[model samples]
Target: MTDLALLQALGALCVEAGRAILDVYDAEAIVVRSKDDRSPVTDADERAEEILHAVLAKLFPGVTVIAEEAASRDGAPTEAPETFLLVDPLDGTREFINRNGEFTVNVGLISRRAPVLGCVHAPALGATWIGAAGRGAFKAEAAIRDVPAPAAYRPIAVRQRPAAGLCAVASRSHADAETEAFLEKLGVVERRSAGSSLKFCLVAEAAADVYPRFGPTMEWDTAAGHAVLAAAGGAVTRPDMTPFDYGKAEAGFRNGGFVAWGARD
Candidate 1:
């Protein structure tokens, strides 16, 4: 399929997955469990993953999918193919548990060790971001069961760095001293805290100028948002200023520290 078509399909699937999440989110009691890795998991995560897996199977046929819940259950592959899909059915589980409306459904397509297309949907916030390498990025206000037409989405891009000062975004749930020190070194004048992959979206939309993540993150955690930010004319790199790419199956798909910038510095 074309990149644009794949992005649209992923967006729709993420929206559907978001609906499943909301169903569990609205329940009187949300049951949570600990994964083998000691991370939190919920019915919302599994249910949404089920939906994404089923739809993706029918849509893509033979493509490999490395989803968070599944990987947590069945150990991750030691090596990945040149192309695959990375999925985090429900990102920011803490935020979801807190009912902060900051969690998201993420689907990203990785090709040649890079995110070529992605879609992120925050159901509670009624927002979605979709992007592809050559097709650019877009944002839409799509509520439950509301799939906005392609034209309804407004194109989005990162802005030039402000001459006055830089604005930075940090994870609300997983802040670390390294990230703080990095931001301080960058001389960021303003800082915003957010949950899930919204930090990448913030920079992608020019709401913030940078997001430095020093804590551990999985490929699924950042791939979708990374795609969006890159498509919006931004970049994600290692703290040392090296390129950031995916398909790190050797390390159980774990990610090292990285910095996301609205514009190249």
Candidate 2:
């Protein structure tokens, strides 16, 4: 999967997973379950993961998967796998519960501890962002096939920070006190709210300059957007400014606070 062609193919697999999610979403409410972490899961998550697993099993038969919906303390292999896909079918069930149109379908492909390809689809919002290392990153918003069109793809980069004012996105429902303190410290002139991975997409598009996640979020929650943000000329860094890496030996599949931006590296 190191080759450019292989990366692109993996991206297409991500898109297919998105479509599977939309199918589940378009149907009526399905069963919702609680994981050990007590996070919510709908039929959408399982169906999408199943679809992705089936496709990748054929495309990259030996590639292991570490999807959020499929993981638990019960059955994780004893050894860490080298390459895998981290999938999040419904990123904001809370938003989906409120019918706020903020959830997304995300898929990330990682090799050697870094995201090489990723795709995120917001069926309700009709937006899709896709990225691959070196080949560049792109987003699409169109109705045709409800899918992204390659011809319309444009390379994205983070906008330079404004000297006088900066805009940032806080979680619409989870804008905690620390997020407020951080935004206030950043001296943002205005603030917007979005749900799910849309927060990261906002920064990637330069619609907003930054998103600081001081709250809890798993690896699946950020991995795809991390790739997109990085591809869009932005980065995700810890409070110490060290870039978050995937495929850690001890961390399993978790994430920590980081910022996303649209600016020069």
Candidate 3:
């Protein structure tokens, strides 16, 4: 598919799944379950992932799609081609359960183990961000009833480092001592807390200067936002300062500690 076509489809899929998530979010009671890994899974997660899987199957026939809830049930494929789809229908279940409106639906296309296109939709926030390789990243008002086209989106990019110091973003739920230590080392002027991929989005749009994660994150957790950051002239790299790679079933798709930086440190 052409870049624009793929982005539109991904944006629509993410928006649709976000609507499904909101359906459960607004309900009286939301059922939650624990997978083997003991992570909480809610009705919204499964329902939205199902919506995404179905649409992705139709959009890209025969592509290997790795979705969080589905992989937990059916097992992730040990091997896949260079190109595939990764979906995290509900990226911040904790925030969603807490009714914080910080959760997001993430859909990413990976090529050569790097995210090429991605869409992060925050249903409760009524906003979505999308990024495509060579085309740049954009943000749009996420309409629950319809997916806005790229024409309705605003292009975004990272900013140069501030003269004072770096503004850092960290996980609101998973912040830890190690992460704090890392942030301190960055000469941060101020620290911000956020849930899900919004941390990466903040850096991508230059709202924050850096995001350092010491806690565990799955590929689906970071892929969409990583793509956006990268497209916006930012980077997500390991503590060792190497590029992050995906399709790691050996590690159960879990990601190591990493730092996301805007244009400058």
Query: What TM-score would each prediction reach against the true structure?
Result: 0.97, 0.88, 0.96
Indicate whether candidate 1 or candidate 3 has the larger lDDT.
1
CA lDDT of each candidate?
0.91, 0.74, 0.88
Candidate 1 clashing pairs, residues 3+ apart or interchain: none
| Candidate 2 Cα misplacement greater than 4 A, ranges | 1-15, 27-30, 59-61, 73-78
The per-prediction tally of clashing pairs is 0, 3, 0
Say which candidate scores most in lDDT. 1
Model 3 spans with C-alpha error above 4 angstroms: 143-146
Superior by TM-score: candidate 1 or candidate 2 = 1
Superior candidate under TM-score, 1 versus 3: 1
Q: Residues 1-265, candidate 3: write the lDDT tens digits.
A: 8786787778888888988999999998878889998999998999899899888898878888899998899888877678988899999999999899999999888899999889999998888888988999988885564688667789899999999988998999997889878877777889889999999999988899899987788899998999999989998889999888888878888899898989954
The digit string of per-residue lDDT tens for model 1 on 40-78 reads: 999999999999999988777798999999999988888
- Please list the Cα RMSD from the true structure of every candidate, rounded to 1 decimal place: 1.1, 2.6, 1.4
